[model samples]
Target: MDNLTHSLVGALIGQTGLKRKTGLNIPALIIGANLPDVDAACFFWLEGVEHLGFRRGITHGPPAWLLLPLVLAGMLWGFDRWQAKRGKRPEGRVPVHFGWLYLLGFIACLTHPALDWLNVYGIRLLEPFSSQWFYGDTLFIIDVWLWGLMGFATWWSLRQEKRGETWRKTGRQALALALVYIGVNGAISTYVASSAQAANPQATQVIASPLPVTSWDREVLLKVDYGYWAHVESSARQDLARPNKISVSPCRLSTATAGANSQLDAFLFWSRALIAERAEDGSVILRDARFYDPRARDRFSLALPDVECEPLAPPSP
Candidate 1:
């Protein structure tokens, strides 16, 4: 999920009466919601596809979940005292309760990874303990519909608060509706994927990637043999349409050469459906079948050693 979605979720959680828990509870919620993304700082030191392997790992795991909120709570507690020392504390501010602040921070931080796991990009939920990647494949990375739904509810809640009426109910209703929407989409993806696999016994895997702005639509990819076959699916349709084969490199990576390159190793670690193709210059190009695009061929690709690439063995049917 995008940062805006994460931030909006945090704010909505805060609007559900949690903001009254402490003087800086709202900030704690908002910042904690995005704290797991601090791993994005890897771009400053790591190059190329290396960040892909590092992101959504340790920082999003259990250890960070437990420690990050504690750190955030302590900072908020210090800030409150600092304000008091300067005689600048807001008169209307509620007393800062370290316990409540920490709870709010923990609640918000937990929402971050939950949202992140709902897309095709995937996340490492048990990172440090196990580097397994989990994918929800239920929603697009950025859903404008979610933005509208949660964004409007948040705004309406704030408006109701200003009017001194019950506002938490509005937030709760919005949260419920959002959950229903997500559940429905998850069901749709599951149905499409299962249907695809059942129809093609030779398929090793099937991915139902949600498309942006169309909750009922999905781009289905079936892994077979040496590559993948893709087609669009709509809930309104009665049957799975014919799928076109995706062009991919038939070259295989040299284990000895790839092991020596950190960049190639990182790319391999993060690529779920890796494909290797021989470039015009004889160098091998590696790409993931999940996100391969001709217009942006180099986006998630890396070049392997210049040695003659080996041919891939035909996959078992």
Candidate 2:
């Protein structure tokens, strides 16, 4: 998920009565929510495509989940002490409790992975121990509706805070609403995916990803013995039995091995379901059916001429 979503969730967590537990708890929550993204720094040193292999890897794994929050808590604790010693601490600063801050940080950090797991982009939750990627296929990377829910709850909470009303209920309510939305979407994705797969008995694997902005729309990717295919259909349609539109040509794998390259490797590693189509010039074009956009077919695709693949036959006139 996006950093803004993570931060907003962190703030919501803080508003759930955790903020009053210790000084700098808000910072712990917000920072810990975004700390797993520290892996993004690899973009500077790692070239194009390499970052894909690296991002959402170790930092999001179990070890980091346990340790990163502690690191954040320690930093917040140290900063508070530093401020106190310099006599620069704010007069209203609450007595800092290191353990409570760590707890808050850990709780905030846990939310990061849970929310991230709600999106199509996969995360390696058990990294180091395992490199397997897990996908929720529940929501888009960014959902304005979710933003509205969290944002409105935040705004309402702040309003009540000014009036000195119990604002924790608002945060808790928002969290509950978000969970319900996620549960509904998960059910929809599951039903749609099953329907799509049942529609094509030949399809060996099916990945149904919910589309953004709409609740019942889904982008379905299918893996056949020969190649991959994709389509978008509405779960809200009365007739899910209606024929699907195959949005792109099936990318057929060649008899020869597609040559290995960094770009192709990274794309293959990240793609959940895809196909390899041979170009006329003996090159191979790998497209992830999951992200195939009719308007931008080339996007999320990798073309490798160096990788040797069986040459495609001349076009049938």
Best by lDDT: 1
Off by over 4 Å in 2: 237-259, 279-282, 294-299, 311-317
Model 1, 107-141: lDDT tens per residue? Answer: 99999999999998899999799999999999999
Summing lDDT over every window of 10 consecutive residues in candidate 1, give the lowest-scoring window. 229-238
Error of 1 at 68 (Å): 0.6
User: Over the stretch 129-215, how does candidate 2's per-residue lDDT look in tens digits?
Assistant: 999999998988888888999999988998898899999999999989998988998988888889877876777777877777885
TM-score of each predicted structure versus truth: 0.93, 0.90
User: What lDDT is obtained when candidate 2 is compared to the true structure?
Assistant: 0.78
Q: Candidate 1 clashing pairs?
A: 249-277
Clashes in each model (backbone N, CA, C under 3 Å)? 1, 1
Clashing pairs in 2: 259-307
Indicate the TM-score of model 1: 0.93
